[model samples]
Target chain A: GAGVSQSPSNKVTEKGKDVELRCDPISGHTALYWYRQSLGQGLEFLIYFQGNSAPDKSGLPSDRFSAERTGGSVSTLTIQRTQQEDSAVYLCASSLTSGGAHETQYFGPGTRLLVL
Target chain B: AQSVSQHNHHVILSEAASLELGCNYSYGGTVNLFWYVQYPGQHLQLLLKYFSGDPLVKGIKGFEAEFIKSKFSFNLRKPSVQWSDTAEYFCAVRAYNNNDMRFGAGTRLTVKP
Candidate 1:
């Protein structure tokens, strides 16, 4: 089975430009999550989606950041007016389900975004 | 809000040496603990997790972690390390009922042969 996959392994964008990162979750996975990993920092939670329920947007850092999961399989994280601070690796993960103690998240290779 | 702390930023050890990485989380409610590892040029993968029962949990690659509720800690350990064990480890915590998971700053382990 193919693992979670992300598009554009690396992206370099100018500050104030918008960038979109895509993620394809594993087959049959009902829970998907997005995170940001900065140098010398921990993974920062960004957003999450579980089945047909509303997406959890509590982790989004600002209004410029948003995500959408269409048809319950693919997700795209959009960052508007990207900042230098937004330069980091964007990782996507998926699990069999959400809110279960036994669920373990499987991560993708991640898309490295560099804002100049 | 919940937060995780990883005591060591970087640790270097020789092959066959014992390994221990400290992790602690601050959360008022019941939580799930996990250790994730990232090898060079690879994606992050689960090492182990603790949800309920059996405070001690073993994971792949001879790794294990003990959950101490009293101290709010879940420290990862291995009896012996190999040169291939060199990688970055992250400690994560999530409330039993919450969807948000928090991660530590990560500890880099360097094992020499």
Candidate 2:
């Protein structure tokens, strides 16, 4: 089975510009999550969708950061007016179901976004 | 809210040497623990996970983790390591009642052949 996949393996953009990162989760995965990985921050959860509905959005750093999933398959994370601090690899993951403590998540290769 | 801490930032060892990486989480409730590994240029993959019943969980590539509830720790260990085992290991925890999962800063393990 194919694992999660992300688009635009590398992206370079100017500061204050907007960037959209795309993620395609595995087939039949009902839960999708987005995370940001940087040198020091490790991995920071951005947002998650459970069957097209996000139960929690608090993980998003700021209002400029938003994510949406359609058809319970593809998810897009949009960073409006991106800053230098937002430069990092954006990762996407998915599991078979949601809200299970024992669920194992499969990760994508990630999109490396560079804000210059 | 939950937080995870990886005590070791980096570890270096020779091939066939024993390995241990510490991971601690700050949460009082029941939690599920996991170890994930990322090889150079590869995506993160599950090493193992501990939910209940057994305190020791074995994962791929001769990796295993012990969940100690009394100490709030889940340490990953392996008796013998290979050069191919060099990678970044991340410890993660998810509370029983929460949908969100917390991850540690990760430990970089370099195995010298």
Q: Which candidate is the best by lDDT?
A: 1
lDDT by residue (tens digit), candidate 1, A65-114 = 99999999999999999999999999999999787666989999999999
- Identify the candidate with maximal DockQ: 1
User: Comparing to the true complex, what docking class would candidate 2 get?
Assistant: medium
Runs in model 1 deviating more than 4 A are none
lDDT of 1: 0.96
TM-score between candidate 2 and the true structure:
0.97
* DockQ metric, candidate 1: 0.89
lDDT per model vs. reference: 0.96, 0.91
lDDT, candidate 2, B1-113, per-residue tens: 88999999999999999999999999999998889999999999999998887899999988999999999999999999999999999999988857678999999999999
DockQ of each: 0.89, 0.68
Give the 10-residue window scoring lowest on summed lDDT in candidate 2 chain B. Answer: B93-102
Candidate 2 segments exceeding 4 Å error: none
